[model samples]
Target: MSRIKKLLMVVVALLLLAVGGLYLYKDAAVRSGVIASGDQVLGADSTTLDSASLDLFGGGLALRGLKLKNPEGYQQPHFFQLGGIDVDVSLGSLLARRIVVPSIALDGVELLVESVIDLDGPRLNLLTIRDQLRSSRVKNAEENSASSGQRFVIESLTVSDLKVMGLMTIPGGGSWPIDLDVPTFEIRDIGKKQKGVLLAEVVGIILVAMIDKAIDMIESDGSDKLKIAGDIRRGLKFFNRGLKESGLDPKLGKKLLDDAIQKGLGDLLKKKKKDR
Candidate 1:
């Protein structure tokens, strides 16, 4: 072979190696970032991801086996778990200050909502997570206003095949489980008005949305489990407060609480009191 041809071959080999190395680094970086950001935002005992892959040319990212452990004192193993997530990102925007994600889809999500009724009243796992996210958001806003962390603008996000399981721990150490299948839900234009939002904030947005939906489902149902909704509503005040602290619209949260109070909780509580 000619010397120039040999040199060309060597250059091609080096380029391939460089590309491979870059892919590996990007994969590891994405995995680490997801776990760290999730733990910080969720205040989980531990956050884990099985695998994360970035399609460099396609600007697509896939994540699998993501799990967020419950906070200390919760009986459930995980507060949240998902089978997989697929995200479509704008390649051009990756180089810009705010990464633009066109769509995100999460599948096989399992959320454990536990209410422990003890001497200290009822402690709900979902409420606890909400409060933790609120605190994290406040701390982030205070500390990282000028920091160079990656921010995102997600145009649309959807969750499918969601299972919301409720567990109640009674005073005698007995427990009851209620299973509910939540219909798929979607949110759009996240971080658009704000221009960009931190990753933790994105998580907070999703969690708050899910929590609101769960509460609605619990309240609307007329089964014996409807009683749980009353206990859950007692904590809705914190939910309202969390929405305000997390930068969500306070007026909307207030309206939700007011409507819930007007619609059912008052009547439900009165019935319980009369029955006892």
Candidate 2:
């Protein structure tokens, strides 16, 4: 009986060591994957993580300090910096072939736009990144069998302390300075089982939500703002359908908005000429 008890003790110690090693390896993989995904999605080489720790036993993950630099040829030092992501994971779902993160809180989101003279001329900052991801994702989806596809789900997400700043030149002329503060934002049903969500789809959501708020800061006439909003809604409906095939891509919603703004400016210029 004593020998048997000693054997059991040894087994338990070995098991603990194994679990400890596995957890440490997982932490490293998480950091590496975070940087790799960011680089691929943004088309930039500069991506790094400050820290990532996951308490699997506690069913939670904490990630902090991520920097996403601009794509090649852009002069901006970095596009966005993410402070952290705190997630409450559904631990049991990991073994079931689906990653189900129930709640996620993101903090310290920032976007910086800088004036850079690209030889290729001007380009949309964030929208360009979305276009790259959409093109590749659609191509891969076509290549793969739908039945074998994987899923990533976030039941609910909350983002706080978002700050966007800097200026970009419009089509007609002149540059517009942007300074925005998004204190609290929430999204539910991301990557739902019944109706899955894609990157472009989420981008559309971000675009619409951000624009809806930012438009108010433009200091335009009330009637003018309303007219712009009407144009934007119609444009989003059109572009979203095109990009997503059946539904709206909301990610490409910004494209439609840019076009609308350009047309409105052109029309204004024409009216001015007539008045002259």
Candidate 3:
């Protein structure tokens, strides 16, 4: 019994050590990936993935203090930063020919637009990263199609708990800035070939929602507003149907998506102006 107890203790110790090693290794990998990626975004000098509170599970990972430095033109040295992301990677999809980014949940992010360049330029623009990700998905799909039978599929992607600033300019360059404080933003069936078209619909839906709010704020004329809303809804319905055909579970997808939006945008919208 004494020998058996000692053996059990050894086994438990080994297991704990192994788990610790794996978690540390994963943390190192993520740090390396961030440093390499940040080199491109932040040029030289200070940019780092501070790993004080990082954890890696079998199916998911959590990061903290993910900071990005801006180039010479940027107003602040560290122009943008994210507090954390708790995300689950789709390993099966990754093994296949596609970049299957299933979900990304961002928390406490800061978006600072520099006054140096046109707000529309790549550096200062808030949505540039999202646009680049979409473009890369298409380009990668085309490239990978030549190699394997596996098709890239982003079945669902959701982002929630965002504190946004420096959003894109509203139509016709209006003075009333259209900043977004999204508690949630999401996309489903992102791997489909018609992702661009679907994204256009999603954008339209958001535009419609914003326009309704804007009309209320600015006291705009009501003549064609109803017609515009109908058109936007129609576009969303058609695109949403396409998502269903993309081999994704629409019910689960939409639920997660809506949750993200509600947490991200809803919270942002509800905050008092001075508080934001």
Number of residue pairs clashing in candidate 1, backbone atoms closer than 3 angstroms, sequence gap of 3 or more or interchain: 0
Q: Which candidate, 2 or 3, would have the higher TM-score against the true structure?
A: 2
- RMSD of each predicted structure: 9.0, 8.4, 15.8
Candidate 1: clashing pairs of residues? none
Candidate 3 ranges with C-alpha deviation above 4 Å: 1-24, 38-47, 52-58, 90-101, 117-153, 166-180, 192-276
- Per-model CA lDDT versus the true structure: 0.71, 0.57, 0.44
**Pairs that clash in candidate 3:** 182-264, 182-265, 183-263, 183-264, 183-265, 184-260, 184-261, 184-264, 184-265
Assess every candidate by TM-score. Answer: 0.72, 0.64, 0.43
Residue-level lDDT for 15 in candidate 2: 99
Residues 100-200 of candidate 2 have per-residue lDDT tens digits of 66888878877765533233433555545445656655553443335343345678888788777776433322345667685587878775743443333
lDDT of 1 by residue, 106-158 (tens): 88888887764333334567777777777877876654467687788899999
Q: Model 3's lDDT to the true fold?
A: 0.44
Give the winner by TM-score.
Answer: 1
Predicted structure 2: lDDT:
0.57
Error of 2 at 237 (Å): 16
